[model samples]
Target: MARYELVKRSVALITLTNPPVNALSSAVRHAIAKSMEHALNDPKVSAVVICGENGRFCGGADIREFAGPLRGPPLVPLLDAIEAGEKPVVAAIEGVALGGGFELALVCHYRIAHFKARLGLPEVTLGILPAAGGTQRLPRLIGIPAALELITTGRHISAQEALKLGIVDQVTEQNACEVAVEFALRAVAKPLSSRRVSMLTTPCPPDLDALLEAVTMQVKKKARGVMAPLACIQAVRAAATMPYSKGIKRESELMATLFNSGQARALQYCFFAQRTAGKWTLPSGAQWNNSKPREIRSAAIIGLGTMGRGIVVSLARVGISVIAVESEKKLLETGKQMVIGMLERDAKRRGVSASLNLLKFTLSLQDLKDVDLVIEAVFEDMALKKRVFQELSKVCRPATLLCTNTSGLDVDALAGVTDRPHLVVGMHFFSPAHVMKLLEVVCGPRSSSETIATAMSLGKRMGKVSVAVGNCPGFVGNRMLKPYLDQATFLLEEGATPEQIDKALEDFGFAMGVFRMSDLAGLDVGWRVRKESGLTGPDVDPKNPPRRRQGRRYCPIPDMVCEQGRFGQKTGRGWYMYDKPGGTNAKPDPLIQNLLEMYRSRYGIQPRNISDQEIIERCLFALANEGFRILEDGIAARPEDIDVIYLFGYGFPRHGGGPMFYSSMVGLERVLERLEHYHQAHPDVPHLEPSPLLKKLVACGSPPVQKWREHIKTMHSHL
Candidate 1:
C-alpha cells in the first residue's frame, strides 16, 4: 500500500505504507505501480519522490510470498517503467533498502539516503540473485567489480559507504524524503538521459575474465558447495559483456535457475527458522511474548579464563559494567591484561574506543555482591560449580540472577545448591563467546519465566541468537553431538581415514570436517570428560572388553591419541599432527596410520574400504536421530530451535538447514530405513538404532519439520 500526495506544489510524493520493514508484497507492488502511473500522467507533477512511511524504506520482497506463485505486476517490468518515465523519480532511503528494495532505488533517477540508512542486494543470501534488473543496472551505475562484490556477498553498506560507492547521490542527517523531494525538483530541469542507469555503458575492467575467475575461486573456497554466489557471478558477467536488454534477460534466467533450487529452499527455511527459534514457549504458557525480562545494567563473571574473558568483553561492549573474578591475584592480573587487549583489538576493528573503563577484575567473590547478574564461567566440574553457587548464594543479594556458562552439565543439580534456584539458568555461550552468535538459554525445571526471559534478552543484547531449551545433559547442541562424534570415530575403525571422512562431510557443505573441528577444539577436553565419566582410564573394569563400554560398542581411539599427549592444536597433535605446539595447520601423521594398523591387527578386525555416502549417512543421520530423541524428550520445543542451534553454534551449513530439517529433506522414511540397517549390522551400537520419534514420524508420512512439534507429546517435558 502506498500513499501519494503533492508536495511543494509540483512534486508528487509517493510513500510506501507497510509497517515494520515495508516489504514489497503483491498489494504494495500494485499500489506502487498505480501511484507511479498517476504521478507520470498528472499535469502538475514535475517530478516524484518515493519513500517508506516509517523510518525504514523497505527490507526487501515479502519472503512469505516466495512460498506461493507470484501475483500482481512483476517487479522487473514495473521497475523498468519507473526508469523510463519522463518525470524524474528520486528514492528516499532511511533505515534499509535490501534486495528488491535496493533494486527499486536503482531504477529511480536519483537516490538520497539518510546518515543511518543501510543498503544492499541481499538476495544471494537467500540462494538467489537480484533478478529485478539489479544485476543489469548496478554495474552500469557503479563499475562491474563493485557490483559483483556487493551482489555475490550480500554485505550491507552504510549511507557513507553508499555515497563513496556512488550508489546514492546525497547523504543527509535530515528527513530523507524531504531531501529527496528537493533533489527531484532540481533534477526536473536537467536531462534525464544520463540519469537513466540502464542506458549507461557498464565499465568493464581490462582483466574482466581474470577478475571474475578469481572471484569464482574465492566464492567456491569460502562457501564450498553453495550455488547462489556462482550464479551471481554469471549474472554480473552478463551485465559486463552484454547490452541492458540481454543482460536483464540473462539475470532473469539465472534467478530462475536458483529460485526453485533445493539450496534456495534450505537457505530460505533457515531465514525463517532463526526467527521462530526466538519465540520460546514453556508448558506453563509463559512465553517470549508474555514474560518480562529485567534490565541488566551491570553483571559479574566468575573466573577469567577464555570463556570468562570473552563473556566479560561481550558484556562490557554492550555498555554493561562487568566485574570479573579470579581465584588468585596473579591470575586476576593475567586475565585483566588479556581482556583489555582483546577489547582494544575488537574496538579498533569496530571503529570505537574500548569500553575498558567498565571492566573491573578482582580476586574476591565479594566484588560481585551488588551486580544484577552473575555468570559462573569457572571449570566444568559439577562440585566446583556447586561450591561457587553456594558461595554466591551467601554473598549476592536475593534479587540478583545467577547463571552458569556450562556447556553440558545438569542445571537442576547446580540450581539445587543455590538458595535462589528459580533464578539459576544456563547461558551456554559457544567458545569465544565474544564472537559466536549462539547463546543457548537452558531452562531448568526450577527456572522462573522471568529468569529465562532475562537470560534470553541479555543474549540478544549481546547480539546472540539465543534459543531457550529445556535442561538436559549437554542441552540441545552438545547433547546431539555425542552420536555424531561417535559415528565419526567408528568410521575410523572401519578403515576410513580421518581425511577421508572429513572430506566427505566437507564436500557435503560443512565448513570443517569432524576431525579437523576436533583438533581445533582441543581433543583433551573430550578425553577429560570421558575419563571423569568412567568410560576410560583406571575406572573402566579390566574384565570389560576393550572395544565395549557400558554395553555399547565404543571407540577408544581418541583415548589412545590422548595417551600419546596429543591433546590437540595446543600440543600440536590430535587426530592429525600439526607443525608445532599451538599450530593450526593439520596434516595426517604416519604415526597415527601405524597406530590404527596396530590396533586393527591386535583386534583381528578386517579393514574394508568405506564410501563417502556411507560416511555422510552414518554421521549426519546419527546426528539427526539424536535430534529426534531430543524433540521427543522435550529438550527442544521445535525442530527450528534444534536447527538454529546447529546453525549458529556448531557451524552447521546454512544451505543444508539443520540436522532436523536436513533429515526431513532427506525423507524420514529413508533415514529410518538407513538407521535400521545400521542398527541391524551393529547390534552392540545402541546409538545406531532409530529413535521412536523418527519411526513415528515415518509412519505418519513424515510431515515437514515445521509440523514436527504437533506429533511430540510434551507430557514429560523438562522445561
Candidate 2:
C-alpha cells in the first residue's frame, strides 16, 4: 500500500509504504494512481515528490502475479495521469528503481537520486519489455540510440552514471526524499507541458535504415533464441514511426506475446532460482536465516598455482587483504607477478582504477597469524593438504576460518586434521576462479554455521553465485555432472561418434557439447581422477568388462583415450583433432572416426548411424532423471535449486529453464516413458533405471514436467 500527504510547503509526498522491494503489485499501483489523482486536484499542492518507504523504490512488477490471473489497472494510464499533472513531480530514487518503478520516474518532470541508487527498466532481462510507456517515453527523453541501449540491455545504472547519461536530473547526498520535495516545490512555476517527455518526438539518427539494420544484427548476435530483445526492438521501432498512443498499443501487444513465451518463464525461473539458492539448508538443520557470517577484514591463501592465483585475484578484487603462501621462493615471485598482472588486466577490461584497497602477497605462514580466514589451495593430494591444514591450525589463530579447494575429496577428513573442526569448510572454485561465477560451498559435518555463512559471503564478495551444499565427494554440481559425463562416454562405447554426440547437445542449447567441453577443460583432468580412484589402469579388476569397469554401467572410452596419450587439446588429439598441442582450433577427426569404428567392431557392436534426437534425449533425460532423485532425497531442497546450479555452474541453457525445469516442461509421464524405452532397449545399463519418485508421479497421472513436485509433496506426507 502507498499514500500521498500534501505538506504545507506546496509539495505532495507519494510514499510507497510496502516493504521488501515494494514490487508494484495491483494494490500498490492502484494506490499510486489514486495518490497522483489527489495530488493533481489539490490547488495548494503545486508539485509532487515520490519516494518509497523502505530503501528500495521497487524491484519490479510482482513476479508472483505471473503465476496467477492478471487483473489489474494498466500502468500506462497512471503514467499518463502523472505526465498530465498540473505541476511538476520529482522522483527521489534510492536503492533499486526498476521496471515500472523506473518507468514512473521517466513520467516525472524531474528526478533526484541518492549516490547508492540503482535505476533500470530491467523488464527485458526478465523476458518482457517495460509495458508502462517506458519504451515510448525514454526515447522521447534521451533520443532513440540511448533509449534503445537502456531498454534492450536492461543494465542497471548508478546515480553518477545515470546523471552522466542524462537519465536523472541530479544526484544528492542529502536525504533523497527531502531533496526531491524541495526540488518539486521549486519546479511548480516551470512549464510542465514542455517537461513532459510523451509530448516530444523521438529523435532518430539521420541513417535510420542503417541504425535499424545494426540493431537487428546486434539483437540477433547477442540475444539468440530469446523473444524479449526482439520484441523490445519492435517496440522501439514503433516509437520512431507511430504516434505516442499507437506506439503504446504496439508495446502492449509485444508485451502480451512475450509474456506467454517459454523463454519468459525460463528467465523468471532463473531470477527466482538465484534467490532460492540463497535459502540453503543442511542435514543438521542449519539454514540461511539463522546463520551469521563472521567478518573477514583480512584473509590468506596457501599456494600460488593457476587456481591459487585466481583465488588471490578473487579475494583481492573484493578488497580483502590476502597473504598468499608459497613454499618455493622463485615460484612465489612468479605467483605475485601473475596476481598483479591479472588484476591490472581486469581493471583495464572493466575501464576502472586498478588500486585495490588491500590486495597483498606474502611467502610466510606467519603472515596468516592475524588474518581472519585462510583458504588452502595446495596440490590436491591428501597428505600435502593434511600437513598444510595441520601446520595452519597451529600457526594461525584458533578462531580463524580454514577452507579447502578440493573438488572431489572428503571435506570431513580435511577438517579432521584441524583443531578447530567447526571453522573448516570446502570452498570449491572452478578453474579460472577470478572469472567463473559459480562457487560450490561444501559444509563439513562439523562445520559451524558461521563458517558456512562466511564462505558464502566471501563467494558473494568475489562476484560468485554460491550454492551451499552438504559435503559429498563432488558436492552437488560435480556429483550430478558424473552421470551426464558417464552417459556421453557410454554413447561413445556404443555406436555413436564424439562429433555426433557433441552436435546433438550443441543443438539442444549448451554453448559446447560434452566432448568439446571435456577437450577444452583438458580430458586429463577427469582421466587423472579416474586413475587415482583405481577405476582404470593397473588397479582395474581382471573380471571387469572391457568397455564397462563394474557390473554397473561404465565407459572406458575416456580411459582408453588417456592410455593413448590423447590428453585433449594439450596433446592435439582427443575426441576431435586440434591444430597443435595446447591449441584451441578443433575439427572433425577422421582418425577418431576410424578409432571408434575399430572399437565398435572389436567389441561386436554394430555402428548404426545415431540420430541427433536420440543423443539429445539420452544425455538430457539422464541428467534430468538424476535431478528427480536429488529432489526425492532432499539433496537439493527444491527443483529451482537444481536449476540455479545448472544455469550458473553447468551452462544448462537458461531459456530451457535448467534440466529439472525442462524435465517438468517435457512432462514427467513423457520422461518416464522415454526412460522405459531406453531401459528396455539396453537392459544391462542399470543407470538408465528411472527414479521411483518419477514412476509414482507418472502413475498418479501427474505429468512429469509439470506438477510432479506437488505429487511428491502429497506422497511424502504419507511416508
Candidate 3:
C-alpha cells in the first residue's frame, strides 16, 4: 500500500511501504502513480515529497517477480508519471535507493538525501540494466562518462559522493523528508521548463567514442559469456543518440531480453537464496526466529597462524576489539606483524584509519580476561584444543562464549572440556576467513540457542553467510565434499587423467579443476593429515590391497606424489608441471606421465578412456546424493541453503544454483538412477547407497526442492 500524509504548509508526503528490503512490486508502482495523480488534481497540495516507509528507500524491482511470470505494473510508467507530475516534486533518499528506485528519484525535480544514504543503478550486478529510465535520464542530468561508469559498474556511492557527482541535488543532516519538502516548496514558483530532464540533451565530449570503445572492451573482457553487459552498452548508446522516449523503448527491449534469459532467473535465485541461507533450522527444533543473540563487545583469538591471522582481520573488519593470543613469543611477534600489515592494507583500501587499536597480540591466556567470545584456532589436535578451552574457561569471563575454529572435529567433545558447555560452539570458517563469505556455524549437542544466535549474528556482521548445521564429522560442506573428492580419486583409478577430470569440471563452470585446486592448496597438506590418520602410513598392514581401504575404494595418488617430494606448486610439480616453484605457468609433464604408467604396472591396473560427461556426472551426483541425505536428516533447512554454502564457500557457479538446485534441474529420478548405476558397479562403497528420502521423492513424482520438506512432514504424520 502507498502511505500518504500531508505535512505542514500544504506539503504532500508519499512514502513507499514495504518491509525487510523495500522491493518495489507492481502494486506499489500503481499506488505511487495514483498518488501522483491525486496530488496533481488537488490544488490544496502545493508541493510533493516522496520517501520510503522504512529506512531503505528500495533494493530495486521485486527480485521475486523477476524469477517467474511478469505480473505487476511496470515501474517505468510510475517513473514517467512522477516526471510528468504537475506539482513541484522532491525525492527524499534515505538508506539505499537502487536500480528502479534510484530511477524514480532521477525523475524528481530535486533530490535531498541523508548523509548515510547510498544510491546507484545496480541492476548490472544481477545481469540486467536499469530499465526505468536510469540509463537515459542520468546521462541527461550528469555527463555521459560519469553516467556510463555508474550504470555499467553498478557500484553504489555515498550521499556525499553522489552530491559531489551531481547525482543528488543536496545532502542533509535533518530528516530527508523534511529537507525534500523544503526543496519542493522552494522550487514551486521556479520555471518547470528547464527542470524537465527528458527535454535535455546529453553533453557529448570530444573523446566520447574512445571512452565508449574502452568501456565496451572492458565489459566484454569482464563479462565473457553474459548478454546483459553488451545490451547495457547498447541502451546507453541509444540514450546518447535517440530521443528520451525512443531511448526508453530501446531500454525496455533490452530489459525484456534480459528478463527472458535463463541467466536472469539464475541470478535472481542467487539473491533470495543467499538471504534464506542465513535463516537456519535444526533437528532439535531450535530455529533462527526462536533464537536470541547476546552482544559481544570484545573477543579473543588463540594462535596466530595463517587461519588465526585471517580471523583477527575478520574480527577487526567488523569493528570488534580482538585480543589475539599465541603460546610463544616468536610466533606471537610474527602474527602481530602479519595482522598489522593486513589491517594497514585494509585501511588503505577503505581510505579510513583508527586512532584506537582494534587488535592486541599477547602470549598469555590472561589477556582474554574481559572478552565475551574466545576463538581457539590452534593446531588440529584434540588434546591441545581441549586443554586450551579448559584454560580459557578458567581465565575468561563466565559469560564468555567459547568457539573452536576446527574444519572437521567433534564440537560436542570439545565443549565437554569447557565449564560453560552451553556457550561452546564450532565456528568453522573457510580458508582465508577475511576473504571468504561463508561460515559453517556448527552447533554442539549442548550449545544453547543464545550461542548459535550470537555466532550467526556475528557472521552476518562480518559479511558472511552463516549456515547452521549439526555436529557431524565434517559438518555440512566438508562432509558432502568427501564423496566428491572420492569421485575425483575414483576417476584416477578408472583411467581418467587428472587433466581430463579438471578440464571437464572447469567446463561445467568451476573456477578450477580438482587436481589444479589440490596442487594450488599444496598436496602435502592432505598427505600429512592422511598419514596421521593411518589412512596411509607405517601402521598400515602390508597385506592391505592397493588403492582400496576398508573393502571400499581409496586413492593413494596424493600420497605417492608427496612421497616423491612433488608437493604441488611449491615443488614445481604435482598433477601438472609448473615453470618453477611459486610460478603461475602450468604444463603437462612427461615425468608425471612416466610416474603414472609405472604406478599402473606395479598395481596391475589397466588404463581406459573416460568421457568428460561421465566424469562430471559421477562426481557431482555423488555430492548431490549426500545433499539429499543431509536434507532427510534436517541438517540443512532448505535446498537453497545447500546451494548458498556451495556458491559462497566453494566456487560453485551462481548461475548453476548450487549442487542441489542443479540436481533438481537435472531431475531427481535421473540423478537417483545414476547413483544406483554407480552403486551397482561399486557395491563395496557404503555412501553410494541411495537415500530413502530421495527414493521416496522420486517414486512420488519428485516435486520441486522447496516442497520436499512438506512431503517429508506429511509422510511422518502418516507414520
Candidate 4:
C-alpha cells in the first residue's frame, strides 16, 4: 500500500510500502493509483514526492504476478496518470530501483537518487522488456545508443552513472525523499511539458541501421540463442523510428511474444532455483538455519600451485589473513610471487590497494598451528591428501576445520584418516578459483553440519555460489562430466570428427565443446586419473579385452593421445593443435584424425555416418543420464542442485536452464524413451541406460523438475 500525507503543508509525500523490495503488486498498484488520485484532487497539495518504504523505490512489476491474470491497475496507465498530473512529481530513489521499480521512476517528473542507489531496467534478464513505457522513455532521456546497451544487458548502474546518463536528475547525500520533496516544490509552477519524457523526441544517430546491426551481431554472439536480448534491440529500434505511443505498443507486443516463451519459464525457474540451492537440507535433520558457521578470521593453505594461489588470492582479498604453506622453500617463493601479482592486478581492476600485508608465506606445517581453518589444495591424489590431512590434524588447533580442495577424490576417506573427521569437508574450488562462481561443498557421512556450513559460508564470502553435495567419486559436476566426456570420445571412435562434435555442442549453446574444453583443461589430467585406476597402463590384466574396462566399454583414444605426449595446450597438442605450448588457439590437427582412423581400423570397427542430432543426443542424453543417476544415489539434494552446478561451475546456457532442468524442459518421457533406445543399441555403454528414478518419474507421468525431489525424497538421501 501507499502512504500519503502532506509534508511542509504544501508537498504531498506518498511512500510505497513493501518490505524488502517494493515490488508493484496488484494491491500496491491500486494503492498508488488511489494516492495519486487523492493528491491530484487536494487543492492544498501543491507538489508530490513519491518514494518507497525501507529505502527502496520499487523492484519493477511483481514478477510473481506475471504467471497470473492481469489485476488491479495496469502499470502503463497508472504511470501515465502520474506523469499527466497537474502538480509536479519527484521520484525519491534509494537502495535499488530495478525492472518495474526503475520504470516507475522514469515516469516521474524528476528523479532524485541516493548516492549509493543502483538503478536498471533489467527485464531482459527475466526474459521480458520494460513494457511500461521504459523502452520509449529511456531512449528519449539518454539517447538510443546508451538506452539500448542498458536495456539489452540488464545490468545495474551506480547512481553516479545514472546521473551521468541523465537517467536520474540528481544524486544526493541527504535523504532522497527530503531532497525530492524540495525539488518537487520548486518545480510546481514550471511548465510540465519539458519534464514529460513521453513527449520528448529521442536523439537519433545518423548511422542508426549500422548501430542496430552491430548490436544485433554482438547480442547474438554473446547470448547465442536467447530471445529477450534480440527483442530489446527491436524495441529500441521502434523508439528510434516510431513515436512514443506506437513504440510502447511495439514494446508490449514484443513482451507478449517473450512472456509466452518457454525460455522465459526456464530463466525464471533458474532465478528461484538459485535462491533455493542455498537453503540446503539433510536427512539427519541438519539444515541451513540449524547449522551455524564459524567466522573465519585467519586461514592456512597447503600447496601453492595454481589452485592454491587462486585460493590465497580469494581469501586475502576478502580481508582474511592467509598463511600459504608449501613443502619446499623454492616452490613457496614462486607461489608467493604469483599470488602477489594476481592480487595486485585484481586490486587495480577494482580500484583499491592490494591486501598483500595480510598474507604470510611459510615452508612448514607448524606455521598453521593457530589458523582457524586449513584448505589443502595439493594434487588430486588420495594418499597425498590423506598425508596432508593427517599432518594438519596433528599441527592445527583442535577447533580448526580442515578442508580439501580435491576435484573428485573421496572426502569420506580423507575424513577417516583425521582425528577430527566430523570437522573435515570438501571445498572443491574450480581451477582459476577467484574467477569462477561455483563451489561444491562435499559432505561426508561423518562430516558435521556445522563443518559443511562453515565451508559453504566461507565460499560465499569469497563470492561463490556454493552447493552442498554428498561425497562421491567426483561429487556432482565432475562425476556427471565423465559420461559427457566419454560420449564425445566414443562418437569420435565411431566416425565423428573433433570439429563436427564441437560445432554441434557449441550451436547447442555451450561456451566450448567437449574436446575443446578438454584441450584447454589439459588432457593429461584425465589420463593420469585413468592410468592410476588401472583402466590403462601395465596394471590392466593382459587377458582383458582392449575395448572393455570393468566389463563396460572403454575408449583407448585418449590414452593413445596421451602416449604421444600431446597433453593439450601445455604441450601444444591433444584433441586439437595450438600454435605453441600453452597457446590458446585450437586448430584441428590432421594427425589426430589419422590417429582415430588407424585405431578404428585396428579394432576392426566400421566407420558410421554420425549426424549432428545423434552427436547431441548421445552426448547430452548421456550427461543428463548421469544426472538422473546422481539424483537416484542422493548425491545431489535435488535436480536443481545439479542444474545450479552446471549453470555456474559449468557453462550451461541460462535459457536452457541446467542439464536437469533442460531434460525436464525437453520432456522427461522423451528423455527416458531416448535413453532406453540408445542403451539398447549400445548395450555395453551402461551410462546411456536411464536410472530407475528417471523411469519411476516417467512412470508417475513425468512430473516437473521442481516436484521430482518430492518423489525422490521418499528414497534415502546421501547428503
Best-fitting candidate, measured by TM-score? 1
TM-scores of the candidates are: 0.99, 0.93, 0.92, 0.98
- In candidate 2, list every pair of residues with a backbone clash: 664-705, 667-704, 667-705, 668-703, 668-704, 668-705, 669-704
User: On a 0 to 1 TM-score scale, where does candidate 4 land against the true structure?
Assistant: 0.98
In order, the Cα lDDT scores of the candidates are 0.93, 0.83, 0.83, 0.91
User: After superposition, which runs of candidate 1 have C-alpha atoms over 4 Å from their true positions?
Assistant: 713-715
lDDT winner: 1
Tens digits of per-residue lDDT, candidate 1, 1-719, equal: 89999999999999999888899999999999999999999999999999997798999899989989999999999999999999999999999999999999999999999999999999989999999999999998899889999999999999999999999999999999999988888999898999899999999999999999999999999999999999999999998999999999999999999999888989999999999988998889999999999999999999999999999999999999999999999999999999999999999999999999999888889888899999999998999999999999999999999999999999999999999999999999998889999999999999999999999999999999999999888999999999999999888888889999999999999888999999888888899999999899999988888799988899999999999999888899988898899898889989989999999888887999999999999999999999989988999989999999999998889999999889988899999999999999988988889999999988999998888888996446776
How well does candidate 1 score on lDDT at residue 272? 96
Candidate 3 residue runs with Cα over 4 Å from true position = 8-10, 143-145, 204-224, 283-285, 354-356, 493-500, 569-572, 577-590, 600-609, 677-689, 712-719
As a whole number from 0 to 100, the lDDT of residue 336 in candidate 3 is 91
lDDT of 2 by residue, 319-424 (tens): 7888888998899989988888998999898888764556666777877888899999998788899999999999998899999998878898989999999999
Q: Give Cα distance to truth, residue 56, candidate 1, Å.
A: 0.8
- N/CA/C clash count, model 2: 7
Candidate that beats the other on TM-score, 1 or 4, i.e. the better one: 1
Clashing pairs in model 3?
none
lDDT of model 3, residue 517: 79
True-vs-predicted CA distance for residue 671, candidate 2, Å: 1.5
- 412 Cα displacement, candidate 2 (Å): 1.1
